[model samples]
Target: MEIRQHEWLSASPHEGFEQMRLKSRPKEPSPSLTRVGANFYSSVKQQDYSASVWLRRKDKLEHSQQKCIVIFALVCCFAILVALIFSAVDIMGEDEDGLSEKNCQNKCRIALVENIPEGLNYSENAPFHLSLFQGWMNLLNMAKKSVDIVSSHWDLNHSHPSACQMKELGVIFYNCSCLVLDLQRIFALYSSLKFKNRVPLTWSKRLYGVYDNEKKLQLQLNETKSQAFVSNSPKLFCPKNRSFDIDAIY
Candidate 1:
C-alpha cells in the first residue's frame, strides 16, 4: 500500500524502544532469587564472628581479678614485717639480763668503815674510850631500881656536878630504888635562867623546890594502894611509899 504503510509506522512496536530495551536489561538472576541471597550473606558473617569472640573473653576475665587483689596485699605486708622483727629481738634479750643483775647487786653492797681522819684533828679532839660520857657512866653503874633524870640543859655548873654524882652513885652503888628528876625540863631551865639575868635568889628557891617536888610526886602517886610484889628477895623491900612504887614519873 504506501510501501506497506511505511513499514507499519516503522515497526510500530517501539514503545519507547521497548522501554529502552527493558532499561538496558542485564538482570538474569532467579534460581529462586539466588537461594534467598545466599542465605542472607552467610548469616551476616556469623554475626560478626560472634561479636568478636565476646569481647575477647571479657578482657580475659578482668585481668584475672586484678591479679588476685595484688597478691592479697603483698601477703599482708609480709606478715606485719615478721611480727615486728620478733618483737624487737625479745626486747633486746630482756635488757641484757637486767643490766647484769644490776651490776652484781652494786658489787655486793660495797662498804668500808675505818678511814675517818679529816678535820678537828688530835684524833678528832681525843676522848673516845667508849665515851658518851663513858656510856653514861656505864648506865649509871648498872642501876638496879631507878634513877630517871630527864635533862634539857641542867648544866648547873657543868651538868649539875655530873648529875649529882649520878644520883649519889645510884643511891650508893646501885642499891638504887628511886631518884626521879624531871622537874619539867628543870622548869624550862629556870625559865631560861629567869630571862637571862642568870637567876639567883638561891636559884629562885631552887626552882621553887622543884615545883613543890613535882606536886608532891603527883599527890603520892594518887594516894598509894599497893599489892603485886613477887620477889626472889635480893632484899625484897617494897615499902618506900608503895603504890605500885612508880619508880620514876616526874
Candidate 2:
C-alpha cells in the first residue's frame, strides 16, 4: 500500500502529502533557554556577591584607615602642645636666672664721697651746687688711674656732672653690667688695703666675675699667705684639756 501510494504521488503530483511530510519533520526545539538563563543568573549572583564582599572589605579598611588617621592627628597635636609647653618653661627659666629685685637693691652700697664747699661765691660762669657737684668733683680727683666698676645699671650716654668729673680725673672707667651692684665689696677691698683714706669710694657700677688684674693680685696674696703657713705651727697636737684617767676610768 505504501509503494502504490508513492507511485500514485509520483504519477499524480500529490502536494498535500508533500506538505504533510514537510510538516511531520519535527522542528528542533530551542535548547532549554531557562536552564541557560538560570546558569547565567547564578553566575551573575556569584559575581554580585563577590563584588559586595570586596566593597564591604574596602569600606571597612577605609573606615579603619580614617580612624587611624584621626588618632595620628591627635597624637601629633598632643606632641606639639607638650613641646610648646616645654619651650615656654625653658624661656621663663632662662629669664629668671638673671636677677631678683631684693638682691638688686640690697646689695648696693651708697657711699658718701666728700662734702662740697658751702657758699663758694658762685658766679654765672661757675654754678656750684654743693651736695651734687662736690661728690662728683671728689670722684674726678680720686680716679687718677684705671677704674673697674660693675653694676646692675649704667647710662653711659647721659652726660652727668659726675661722669665729666670722672673723665677729668684721668680714670679709665670700665663699667660692669651684672645683676647686682655690690659697691660694698669694692669698698671693703679698698678698706682692707687701707686705700680708703686716699681714693674716693664711689663706684659707678658693679661686676660679675673676678677680672684678670684682681685675680692675679688675689693669687699673689694667696701665695704670700701660703709662705707664711711654714712659720705657723702645725695643728697635729691634740687638745691637752681633754682629761682621761690612766687606766679604765671614765
Backbone clashes counted, model 2: 5
lDDT of each: 0.40, 0.42
Clashes of 1: 0
Candidate number of the best lDDT? 2
List, residue by residue over 1-250, the lDDT tens digit for candidate 1.
9988888878777866898899999999989888988888888788888888887788777887788888888899888888656533334322212322123121111111121223323555664333244445656777666545543355446563444344121111121111122222243333445566533322222222221212332212223432121111111221122222243321
Superposed Cα deviation of residue 62, candidate 2 (Å): 2.0
Alpha-carbon lDDT of model 2: 0.42
The candidate 1 region of ten consecutive residues with least summed lDDT is: 104-113
TM match of model 2 to true structure: 0.31
The lowest-lDDT stretch of 10 consecutive residues in candidate 2 is 226-235
Where does model 1 exceed 4 Å of error? 13-16, 28-35, 38-46, 49-55, 87-250
